[model samples]
Target: MKPVLLFLVSTAWTLTGAQYYYQGLMDYLENRLLAIEDRMQFWHEQSHRYHTELKDFKKLTTEAMDALSKEHSLLFKDLEGASVRVDRVEREMDYVESQTSPRACANKADKVVEQGAWGLEESRGEEEEEKDWEEVQSKVSDCVEILSGIRSVKILKRVGSPKGMWTRDPRSSKVYVFNGTSGDSIYQFNSVRDFSSSLGVSSSREIRLPSEFSGTGSSVYNGYLYYIQQEDETDVQVVRFDLMTGMVTDIAMFPVESHALVYSLNPETVADLAADNEGLWLLYAASDNEPNIHLAKMDPDTLDIEQIWDTRCPRENAEAAFVVCGTVYVVYNTRLASRSRVQCLFDVNDMIVSEEAPLLYFPRRYGAHASLKYNPEEKQLYGWDDGYQIIYRLTMKRKLLV
Candidate 1:
């Protein structure tokens, strides 16, 4: 019985020792887990703070970039303004110089206009001489023969402002002239015969164009007059005028930056507007460069620029333009005072000027500020002279290579 009691006491001591060791181990493990949790929480807080900072940093960088971009654009605009100012100053200087030292042709012409009977006779003699020379030249040259055959009969007197667009209705042979800047006067003819009759007695109508259409020139297609005008200070718009309905429609609006050539000046606005069977054409020069004519084909409906010709017109002072059978004929004035003009033909497909020598003349009676149109039906050319205030018709004496 003693041995049994001793063994029981020993076993009880061992169980108490094991319980104390297990309790101690559980407390240590809990302390370690708490420490690990605290470390993880610290790391997570650091990560979140870094993420916030990174986002703020990115936002700041973008804002900075945008601000810099804005500054750059403003600087560029200021520079462009400076360049334009310089150009204007240069042109003014040139004009002043020209006035001081007149050209020989201008001086001679001015002398005749200023002098009385002597001047008149001199001018008349010069004109007669030029006419005789032209006659002889026409007989000599094939191109001149065709150009010479063009008879410019005075059809109308004092149509409108010198700066205007002229076109004829193919269906009715009615002549229509649109003066965009000068009170929007649209001179419309009722019949071919009415063109010669006295203004009040003539069977014709004069109406104000739409208030918004501020065009320099225009083309007629499918019985609609299509023109490009200032949409706003910076935008140019293509619009259509329906003669039958007298309704004006906005076809498209493009920023002036699109062409960088549509001038704000009265004389050098859009040089000309023309249309053929294929599409509409816009004749513009890049930034007051009157000599370089840029021809572009525009979509009639969408007003999208479909194609820009690679050909650069090799002429200065191109006042009137017309497209026939894919050949663009431009009326260029070599001398503003004299009736000296050159008609240059540019082929759109070839992008080169035709080998045909320039028709060294236009209607002698018509003045510098004139608009040209080709009558496909009659196979003739018509011009409205602003200086002379007359409408003239031209027909080729021989078949043109075009």
Candidate 2:
């Protein structure tokens, strides 16, 4: 019994010591947790501060974009008004020039029609005058002089419908004509030969289409049409209409207030699409609020889209008026009065043939986008001048027939 009593004393001492030790450990742990909490609070404050700064920067960017967009809109309106006034001036010029030119160049058949046959003859006495006029049209160095008159007419019309409206793919064909108003009309055209023909052109059955959002542009691809629909007062939605499937899907939405970015949105994945045989290329640029350029290659078969390139112009003054072969030509105006720039020879590898160096340049945009087009089949290019849209044969005169 005495031995057991001694054991109890030792056990009691050990337990008492252990209790104090545990209390000390608990206090240490509590203090450590408090310190950790304080550090976390500091980090949270810093994080909130950075987030605030980021938001401010984004707000500034948005404001800048908004101001630019509004300013550009006003500028376009003024330009349009000026363009109308120029039309009157052109009328006066026409009245003056009409008094002369009793005989001029021949027609498409190389036979004289309006000008008469005798006027087409090469006169030795007037050879120098004819030679000079022809030289201005043919020589590369003379493009500016030839295009000078054209620039005056175009600077005013740049605000209206594209003077250089062109289709990229050659597969387009004339479908049935429909009578409808622009904004109130919903029009659908089919590219299919058989399906479209099945719907008789003179039929009484009427299909009504709705007006798509206007401010955003539209594109036509193989078997599909894509455009942006204004979702609300604050957002825009990208929608695609598949001709084969007869399905409409909203692929992406850009909220004007919450988010502002520029990227490509297509119905199907086109990552594997190579630029060589693909059909229908669509290029769009938005400069004012969102300074972005999108280059998309669309597949004719599956209504698929492949976005190959994206570029940013924060200042929002550049416009890619036209694309030929694999090159993109941009016309830009700086903030400085009457100073403009042409960004040419742009090559985006994914947009066209890979490993190719595309040489392109701004021809002359007296005050607006330059109008130039290239025809691969004919190996020719066309440029619009004041009163004439002139054709240029890119291939040498010797090998043109090929």
Candidate 3:
């Protein structure tokens, strides 16, 4: 019985020890699983934060690229504008240089016999030329008057091109309108009242010219129309058309320097034809190299160049010019539009000195004038500014001679 009890005791001890060891092993495995779960949760949170930061960075970069593109486009436009301005300036400079060179002046002197029969030296003997000039100057001082200022402005019907001309004949009540710089059509009105009426050319007569005129320098005197026609590349033909017959009465071909325009500011006007109290005058530049304006006295009947005079008025910055009596008033302005002013003057009789000439400024109207036609009969200036037809009433005073 003692032996059997010993055996049972030993077996019980061994079973209890095996159960404790199994429990310890299970605890160790559960602790290890819990640690692994905590590590996985920490890693998941870190990955989510990194993704959000990357998305925000991508959005900021896109916005920056869009802003830079807009700036680049604006910069390109500004550069283009600057380039255009620079090109214009360069062209003007080249034109000026070609006109003022010594070679051009020499060529002009060799070709032209400036003093014709009408010149002071040829009109009288060389010995009496000084006396003749003084006498003519005295007569001019007595009869001719200086322009004081513009008294009134009447904006008549706004017609045709921004560069055109309209004038009433000094002898008759007839009004003539030459539309664009180059056209074969001319409109005529019976009277100034008819032109001013709002009928809008319904009462006007459209007379087609035989040939197309080249420039805006055209005029009507008595019953005839005188205009410049381009005859080939370097020559201009002055055509005289009879209003009554509607036929070309005479044509005179005159040589010009080049295709360069007479007025730098007004590129459309190659020459300026003006009628004053002294008769029909042709205002032109001798050559592209000559900066001064030249005046020629033309006989309305013969289409002959009677005399030529160097006006000494610069062609640079000149927009339009008109002759009052025997004096030429050159109106000047900037390329960028400004108040027009009579900056230069030339008198055939040498009655008025340029230094003492009145400072004449046109009332600031619509842009610069494309044409200024003086009517000695009404004592007014018919002007084309932009597209408006303006009439300037004059106030004259006895010229202050020096």
For all candidates in order, the CA lDDT equals 0.57, 0.39, 0.78
* Residue 240 alpha-carbon offset, candidate 3, angstroms: 0.8
lDDT of 1 by residue, 222-295 (tens): 67777666645566667777878888865676433433443222354543567654557776654544445677
lDDT top scorer: 3
Q: Write the per-residue lDDT of candidate 3 for residues 1-402, one digit (tens) a residue.
A: 999999999999999999999888899888888889888888888888888888998889888889989988998988899978866765555355333311101111121122322233344566676765455445453335556667677998787788888888899999988877888998999988888884666569999999998777898888889998885777778899998999999998776754667799988777888998778999998888898989999998988999899999999999999998788889999998877888788878665556555456776678999889998888999998997889999876554222
* Greater-TM-score candidate between 1 and 2: 1
Worst 10 residues of 2 by lDDT: 142-151
Reference-based lDDT, residue 3, model 1:
100
Q: Predict model 1's lDDT versus the native.
A: 0.57
Encode model 2's per-residue lDDT on 1-402: one tens digit a residue: 999999999999999999999999999999999999999999999999999999999999999999999999999999999989977775665444333321212222122233211233354447764764454334222111001011121121111122222212223432212221023223333432332344333332333334343322344444354545554545554556664465674355432332332212211111111112224444443322555555565544443555445533222454323344434434454433232333332334222221232222223334332233333433333333221233444311110000
Question: For this target, which candidate reaches the highest TM-score against the unseen true structure?
Answer: 3
Q: Against the true structure, what is each candidate's TM-score?
A: 0.53, 0.34, 0.66
Instruction: Report model 1's TM-score to 2 decimal places.
Output: 0.53
lDDT of 3: 0.78
